[model samples]
Target: MTIAWASFTPWLALSGGVLIGLSATLLWLGMGRIAGISGIAGSLFSLKAASGDRAWRWLFLIGLIAGAFIVHLLTGGLFEVRSGYPIWLLVGGALLVGIGTRMGSGCTSGHGVCGLARLSMRGLVATLTFMGTAFVTVFVIRHLLGFGGSA
Candidate 1:
């Protein structure tokens, strides 16, 4: 198997991972809540949460969007990512993720990061399933279907 050496950015990826982990840790330490995007987004629709809970949830959600904006500003431009899929396909995939997040108890950041760190058995299973599924998906799309990009 050949490696995509030109596309590899291990340093950048590791730095991003560190930043995410640190933010999650700080959120947990300061607010006693998991920094799970799905939960934060879903909590916005809850009308009966306690005042403090609602406030922090909203803050977290806003912070998430704002953080990305700030990063774009610092970087002087938005990064361009080349995905071969059309907008409709991207939206469809996002909708499917919403459903999966609802069914699976949390999204990747929630289960794969925070939950796994806490040593939850469910988190272990979810992470393994997700990683395995992702590997199979790339293999099928690239090798079997032969639709992967040139780069």
Candidate 2:
């Protein structure tokens, strides 16, 4: 039950959380849209999406990548490429996440942040389900199977 003290960065984590919250709030207030990455990305290429809608989605997605790149550049490569996982496992996990997001109707940003902010019951259920599943998965991987270490 030891904390990963060396990896802990509370202030940076808090700043990131605040930035996420602020960005989500701004997107909601300015455009009346939930800042859900899955929803934005999923519908980006849909035939039913309007040209304007697609434009914004593209810009949003670009901004996300650009933001991370800018931070990496500014920090002189503070971020590192993750290693140690098989390509098959990574792809499988990504596929599962995509499927889960579709089944859940939203992601953490939508359900946990915006939905909860609006006091929606569905959001609470979705967030709880997501957290519960994550907890069990991590426990099983790290304790039971003993394969999750800094990966």
Candidate 3:
């Protein structure tokens, strides 16, 4: 187990975590809503919701995309933006994530961050399952299957 110390930026990681936490906190306090990306996105398609409900979701998604662009501009091509995965794998992974988020009733931002902060048992269980599954998947793929160096 070796740390990639050359690429490690603890300060940046901490600041990003703090920013996410703060934004989640603010969203909760201001709107009495959890800042779960999947929930917010899924709700946009709800026929039961009021017409006015979709605006915030759209804005939130737009802001997320725009923020990535902003970061790219600020970093000035220093970042490695591409994942080395094949397109089919990326698409499959995305579909799986969408399905998982739907089945779990929340994504990582929702369950791991907001739900845990609110002390919900569902959040704890979901987060544990997510982390455990990720650990097992990585172990199987990298150690057992010997695909570690490919990606």
User: Best by TM-score, which number?
Assistant: 2
Worst 10-residue stretch by lDDT in candidate 2? 142-151
**Roughly what TM-score does model 2 have, to 2 decimal places?**
0.90
Give the winner by lDDT: 2 or 3: 2
Q: What is the Cα-based TM-score of model 3? A: 0.87
lDDT of 2 by residue, 50-128 (tens): 8878988889899999998999889898666788877766788789989898778889998998889899999999999
C-alpha RMSD values across all candidates: 2.5, 1.8, 2.1
Q: Can you list the residue pairs that collide in candidate 2?
A: none
Q: What local lDDT does model 3 show for residue 81? A: 61
Query: Worst ten-residue run, lDDT, model 1?
Result: 142-151
Clashes of 2: 0
The local distance difference test score of model 2 is 0.87
- Residues 34-130 of candidate 1 have per-residue lDDT tens digits of 8788877776764666777787777777888899889888999746767676675568767977787878878788999999889989988998997
Question: How high a TM-score does candidate 1 get?
Answer: 0.82
Model 3 global lDDT (CA atoms, 0 to 1): 0.85
| TM of each candidate vs. truth | 0.82, 0.90, 0.87
